[model samples]
Target: MTERPTTTTNAGIPAPSDEFSQSVGPNGPLLLQDHYLIQKMAQFNRERVPERVVHAKGGGAYGVLQITEDVSQFTKAGLFQKGAETDLLLRFSTVAGELGSADSARDPRGFAIKLYTGQGNYDLVGNNTPIFFIRDPQKFSDFIHSQKRRADTHLRDNNMQWDFWTLSPESAHQVTFLMSDRGTPASWRHMNGYGSHTFLWYNADGAKFWVKYHFKTDQGIKNFTGAEADAMKSVDPDHHLRDLRTAIASGDHPAWTLQIQIMPFEDAAEYRFNPFDLTKVWPHGDYPPIDIGKLTLNRNPENYFAEIEQAAFDPANLVPGIGASPDKMLQGRLFSYPDTHRYRIGPNYLQLPVNRPKAPVHSYNKDGPMTYVNSGDPVYAPNSMGGPVADPELWKGESYAVAGEIIRSAYVLHPEDDDYGQPRTLWEKVLSDTDRAHLVANIVGHASAPEVTADMKVRVVEYWRNIAKDLGDHVAKGLAVNGS
Candidate 1:
């Protein structure tokens, strides 16, 4: 009726003054005895969660993945069985951007999905493109650093980005893709996504296969020209996030067709190219994608912080039929995602409702900072107090054989490990004439930014030439740079 109430601290104790801190005297310093003031200051200092190191800026939504075809011959994951449907959440993001970065920038989009399945939670974390910049995990931190701001000037140096890519020759393919129109997708719903790393899928019959995922958009592939994207950056920085929400709210559910390209286990050892390389892609002509399911986003989160920001996806969240391969970056991600979640959220991040498994959780996991439940059962295994034991009979994953030296070294080089040919193919066959022109313009524009050095500009042309002489010459001409 008249007035609501006074503000309180996190502990909910009342009688507070936000205007001034608890001080001994009007002109003196603050007092530590006032727990409320201390709590307020402490909470203010920690109000912001540590943004994700990569994929820091993102938008998330609730969805469902439904099996559209029978793929039981490949794997026995209940989510992939015919006619099966599972609740899911997808978070789309821009890599290397801050939490306030523009959405329409020309960058690789983070496409991470988590499925709450009967067996457990399955995370298919990937990107919009089918290939990556580097194949090793140790270089991951360095690579991301190059794409980020510099220490001295506090600005994103294009010279730094190009230097990293040009030095790491394996980045040719992804760099070419980035400079193309596909990088600035029209909207989150209009672009396709891929699980770029090679994964393993084993069947009930004990046969294993290497698999790659393709989530083709149902809204049709649409992209913005460099000019259009640049103009939109000024107009709407959050266009993608807003479009996704509006479409879902108006009952226009955005969807994708989940496809898979599987290679036989025996063929992987003798394949023409390294099947597990993150920087390369298997030719679709060799192993075509087979449609398997549909993923549709029909719901929006009620609370962005609780549902979207707290959602975590880890490559280590493997199920019975599906597992990981020898992709080095992927191998590193299996450990890093969970560790970061623990640090950013808390030790009990999984206990949050947004991340909890739909299936019953029976573990000896007891109390932590935010643990919601503490069943009065035995807290440890190997006790006569009737604690649950590990069950291997439900869906035991098939066994895989391994033999290698214990020492650390690079993956054995295949005959086609060089980075030139595939990217050349992309320039010649995939990009149309208009697309090629736009690519040249885009490369020139980025290279001519005020921050790039004259030396790095020369290197940029040389890097483009490494992909193809004509493409490189065109970029050089567009930039009006001499052959020096």
Candidate 2:
């Protein structure tokens, strides 16, 4: 199976020798005229691509999504066709960390999946947690800046993070989840993945439904205690990444059950909660998830940089039957995600094998760096020379009626828009006593970090107190931050 032995330059010219570079004599000055050596040195100097702005540290694997049930009644997307199996890749990573940061850090994990379908590439870009820190896209840049290093000392300041969270009340629900044990998952295999925002699913009949995605792990949920996570950081920084590769390499393939909760198209208007709000979840009691398929990751990537590093996921990459909802964050992401990818991976990123669709792409966009193929077909539309033309009958997207003023203002108020309700409910009902204790400890530990200023600590306590009275008392006691 081995090819004949050969050494060549990047352009495939026969190399003189990889072992020794050409020189004037045995002990003379090195020759700069050796083009192959110069080529090698130049390529070596440009080996790395720009690191991702966020979710920098990650690992990915090849997998299959097998449809177990007939969800065609909900959507005409080919991947959801009953008994269909599609090739896919899922990448998991720690947010708010650099490429070399510890995987054991207590932060939300990015759960981005790209499904190669016959129609096109559909990406469900999500995270482990069902909620995010902020809803409006305007605050996204500032919020990320707070989590990242400071401008003055280049140090991560907990005060800056809390300051942003306290100022933005909507961060409570996600912050509560972040401080819980679930934040530090045992491995990428054990935690669940969620399409946190609500999406729109359209049937062949043109009937639409508001939907939410949940990928429950088959391995069952497992998480590390805060103390254990901190200790593991010192022992093995890439614990999660190592565990994933080792498990797959040993043939212990991991899997998740894909389930979605669908809401009637008209329900968005009359529901008690704003159905399009990313901060809220459609209660299972109201719209229970319907089991759809299974996802199994059986193959590890041969080259991490080629496959995983180059892999890009965007919320805007929707197919015919799958579309977006009016969720503000989802709307913002529909634009922002692809824009960042265009800058990071280039406009021709989809040409990369990892991100490209298995289906035939008849796009007029023809040129960019590293673009090797030209179809010889005409490039522009509305031409008599027979270019690719749109056929509305073949694949028409779902459309809805809209009647609203175009303005830059706050969200329309709902009866229960306050941030404290969900987190308070989570703290009071969902978490057990031990869970509550750990959550309090995590908050006190992080909120009381060395970088947290006294004023910021006061605001943090206020933020907690607003969530729940007893919860605030516990955090205050843990941090010894005095009265209201």
Candidate 3:
């Protein structure tokens, strides 16, 4: 059999040689007429797209979400309909890291999922931890700025991070968690995912239930010590990514049992804890997780760039049954996430194969750069020709009565809004003796950074002291010994 010959073309027409461009003479400079060379150089220069501002370092997998338990009473979404299953893509990332940053960095892990249901795309954008550093979105930028490098040194400053945390008392709960054992997960498979903010679900009968998503890892919880995590960072910078890919490839598929804590819509008004506060969590004793389904990641992406990098998950992508709540962070993210996608990816990014809804999409949005799908029919609505018409019966989603002043006022925080309760609970109730020891060690190590001042260190120690006198003393002892 004859082998196929290498061919280059101006436009599919064969060219003589790709190695050398046409020139005036053998030793002469390349001619300006070498369109192929020019084209190649131009395309190469424009090869890369912009990276995400947060959750930049990530690993993703393709999977199927199987509804194992009946939650039809809570949500009428087809994905949760009795025994229904849907294709899903999940991405896990470190919030403070760049694309090439070490996977084992001490940061919140982004646990975002994009579900392609028959109804539409549903994205549950969340993190590994249940609560966040800040309750309000207004302080979000400032919190992130503190986590990032300082302006003068362009170096990650412990002072900035600690200063922000000390000022924003709301950060105590998440800060405590970050300094705990769970901060450095063993791998993506060993950690759980959480819908950090409250969401809403409406059943077939138009009854709404506030919910918090809890994805418990089927592999069981596992985490690394501070020293172990730091060692792994040096040994394998992409350890988490590699672990996820290898596990899936070896048929050791990782799974999460999807559970939801549902509260009646009326309860939000009188709940003990502020349900809308991103910094607080609804106690399991009050609202327990009713099993909804199982999410299994059984397949690795064939190409990271095509399948994972281009994947966009937005909290706003809600279906008929699933809806948004008054959680300030959730509300802010509903607008910001998609807007960021539009800026990072193109305006028609949803048209990308990775992000496109599996179900048919009909919209007036048209004529953008890289618009792969042509409506073929007229793009405008109210046309003489019948295009897609909105079905009020299907489109009219669940609604609740809204009666509030149109003023920019803060949501009333609960009386128990002191950040100590949960952290104290975590310290005394949740963590083992070994875990507590490690937590102190981690906090001391982080606090001992040369850039962090003595005052800031004392403030952090005092902050923890507010959580639990014992925990605060232990951390203070470690700080003192470490010369913080």
Top candidate on TM-score is 2
The TM-scores, one per candidate, come to 0.93, 0.97, 0.95
Candidate with maximal lDDT: 1
lDDT of 2 at 299: 97
Give the alpha-carbon lDDT of every model.
Answer: 0.90, 0.89, 0.88
Question: How do the residues 250-340 of candidate 3 rate in per-residue lDDT, one tens digit apiece?
Answer: 9999999998999989998877778888888899899987887899998898989888888999999998888888888888898999999
TM-score for candidate 1, residues paired by index: 0.93
Which residue runs does candidate 2 get wrong by more than 4 Å? 1-4, 394-397
User: Candidate 1 residues 83-136, lDDT tens each?
Assistant: 999999999999989989899998999999999999999999999999999989
Q: What is the TM-score of candidate 3? A: 0.95
* lDDT digits (tens) for residues 1-484 of candidate 2: 9898788887888999877888888878889998988999999997777888889999989999999999887888888899999999999999899999999899999999999989889999999988999888888889889899998999988888998999999899999999999999999999999999998888888778888999999999999999999999999998998999999999999999999999989988878767777777778999999999999999999999989999999888888888888888999989988888788878888888898889998877888877865555688887788777887643454778878889886665567667788899999999999999999999999987887888888888889999998899888888788996
The alpha-carbon root-mean-square deviation between model 2 and the true structure, to one decimal in Å, is 1.6
TM-score of 2: 0.97
Candidate 3 global lDDT: 0.88
Instruction: Judge candidate 2 against the unseen true structure and give its global Cα lDDT, from 0 to 1.
Output: 0.89
